[model samples]
Target: MNSTHRKALINKLGKERYRTLINNDSFPSLPNDIKEAGLLKKQSNLDQVSHTSESKSRQISPTCAEIKSQQSSHLGAVDFASASTYEMNLESEVVQADVVHEQNPNYVSGNSLTFGDISVPISSCHPYQGFTKPDLRYPQGDDQEDSNITDAQEVFEHASLDGIAAIFKGLVCGAIRTTSPLADGLKPSKASVTTVFPPWGAVDCLLSLDICEASVEPLAAALFNATVKWAEKSLHIGFAGGASLTIPNSEVTLKGVRDEAIAQVFGSEIQQAIQQSRIRIQEMEKGKLTTDCVSMIITEKGAFISLSLGLVQGLEIQKKLYT
Candidate 1:
């Protein structure tokens, strides 16, 4: 280019544009002349961007409007007027709290169940002294001493004792069946409780007893004769004793029905035995009794307990058999 052409170009462009062209940075950082020319185009682009952003802001989320419309539709569809009588009543009725269980009659309720033991006052006096008793040891005997009891005597004694026991048991049963409340030794019937039904209870129930035999004259004499040989044979007295409780109303017998319950201490067999023991007053046999050597005690308790102590020494037995 010539100096004249360059001069004319510089005169066409401004001083600032001329200076910017002289500095010359890069393609994007254009010269002032080109930048000024494109300003209106750039402003048009900015206006398009602003319009796109405004359109986006004006648009609502897809879900929000739909959700609101759905909520209003649901509210309109509710069957508030079509509610059933039962549901309406239930809603109108008063709500009550849960009921508590009732207390037990047999025990304390709403309290601790722990129990404590009771302490009793003890005697402060000195402990009781042991009884001053005489020496109860048996005397020393000869080692060569032999028993004098024979086999025949032992057999006889056993049979007699067994017979006595059987009769005694039967007699008690018979008394239970035959003995009347009037004749029995029990006290007057009083207010009592019946165990038959506990829930529907009764206060009065009858209680009675019977005294089988008060006179033990035969028993004593028989005991004596039985144990006479024991003293002569063995040093130890022949002792055999035990206790038993017999309930009443054990046997059932009827002539019309021709029925009879098997009985432990009844029937014709037992009755025959009783007849043998039941001797007339004139025919009653009496045996000699030694007060010192013989000791007897018999006790009765309300037809329930019977205790007998039949102690007969050799001398007592001899007296009954011989004298």
Candidate 2:
């Protein structure tokens, strides 16, 4: 508590210790001493802080604006490079598409060119025109299809005749009977049957012809007329046509058989005559077929040939009675 004791205590402490205590601001009893110590320590701490902050600021000195401007420059160069590459790719694609379009407009397998108006493509070299395929059987008219039927019928008739004619002529009439105008129906000759083999007595005859008259009718008429003419020439018996010289329907009488013999023996000559006559008849009977109709009848007994003839166009039936 005295000044001497305080002086002794101050001497015991070293000068460095005293300075450390003052700098630390440990003794705050005297206001002036406390103020002076605090001021010295504050000044030293400020100098150290300023030195550290100056070093740190120098290390990270670039401003925010400067950093942003550098980034923008690099990004702009990258963008420009990418844009140039994209434009090149786009132009190449356009050129390739145009070339492909020019080379193959339709893109069809056979032909490259396309028909604008139509859906289907046409070949450059067409093998066929107008029609897809042609039919040779029926050429012209639609109704000509029926002509095939007629042709087939004729062929069948000829085949039938060929098969049976040989057997029929040799066998049916053993004695080989010829025409006898004076004889009546199927009179059996006292002739004995010697041959038992076929074709000696078996006979088949068929007649087929196309006429305005019914199918059987025309055949019968032609055969009848032929028989009558044969009898007149062979027997030297000239009788009136429809009178005594009568040939029944389909019945090969003794006289009628004679005519068929003449026809068969002299076939080529007879056929030629008939063909020539037919041509003349065709010319004469052109429009007459439709207007003045004539019918040829073929019957089981014999054939009939008849024609319609009227001297006066409009006359009563009784007016033309025989006087």
Top lDDT hit: 2
Candidate 1 residue-wise lDDT, 19-72, digit = tens: 222333442332444555455345545654654564355343554444445445
The TM-score, computed over Cα atoms with residue i paired to residue i, of candidate 2 is 0.15
Model 2 segments more than 4 A misplaced: 1-113, 122-323
The pairs that clash in candidate 1 are: 192-203
Worst lDDT 10-window in candidate 1: 253-262
Q: lDDT at 183 for candidate 1?
A: 50
| Model 2 lDDT tens row, 1-323 | 45555444444432222134323345324434445456556654675465346435434223433543444565432222112111011111111111223222221134322111122223432211122333457556746655654454311111122222332232121212122333764542221111111111111111222222122322323333332332332321123374444443233322221234324432333222322333223534663212111223333423332222221210121121111
Cα displacement (angstroms), candidate 1, residue 216, comes to: 7.9
Q: What is the lDDT of residue 235 in candidate 1?
A: 21
